[model samples]
Target: MSKIDEYIAKRSKQSADFAREYKEESQKLQVAVEVRNLREELGMSQRKFAELVGKPQSTIARIESGKMNVSINVLNEIAVATNQKLTVRFEPVTA
Candidate 1:
């Protein structure tokens, strides 16, 4: 294969990998929506929630926007801040 063709092929593979990773991450961010919902249900603003969680409000914003990576620890912190508990379930992806 020509150099340009090889580069294109490699770039396409990388893009595919990135897209798949992003999809998985975006799926995980569904939890962020839950966070927002629960917070709203409890009548808390973003800033207040951030203060309670000891995180920057921007961090909460980014998580709500699904534009940031949040770990289980951060989620737990958010839970505690909201006076809620965090739960995780691992189920195999059905084919």
Candidate 2:
């Protein structure tokens, strides 16, 4: 693994709270990346995307920056506005 990955893994093993917070932050980052990618794919600026999604520009900014704990309902709204489908599934956790 890369040095950063190794460090994160070691830290995660050493602290349950760290591991849990890491997972949460990682999930938020994943959502942020997805939202940003979709906006870019549609060739829309954040302001335009926000208008399309019927949310404020600041809300889109927060979502794309991983600074917000987005709700599934908001995600669904974004999917609908962007002409995309939203799917959620459960998978087994791995160490």
Which has the greatest TM-score? 2
Candidate lDDT scores, in order, read 0.78, 0.96
Candidate 2 per-residue lDDT over residues 2-28, each given as its tens digit: 898898899999999999999999999
What TM-score does each of the candidates earn? 0.71, 0.94
Backbone clash pairs in model 2 (N, Cα, C under 3 Å; residues 3+ apart or in different chains), count: 0
Q: Per-prediction RMSD in angstroms? A: 7.7, 1.0
Residue 23 shift from truth in candidate 1, angstroms: 3.6
Regions more than 4 Å wrong, model 2: none
Q: For candidate 1, lDDT tens digit of each residue in 11-95?
A: 6577988657755675768967887887688788999888888999999899888787788999888777667878889878431
Q: So what's the TM-score on candidate 2?
A: 0.94
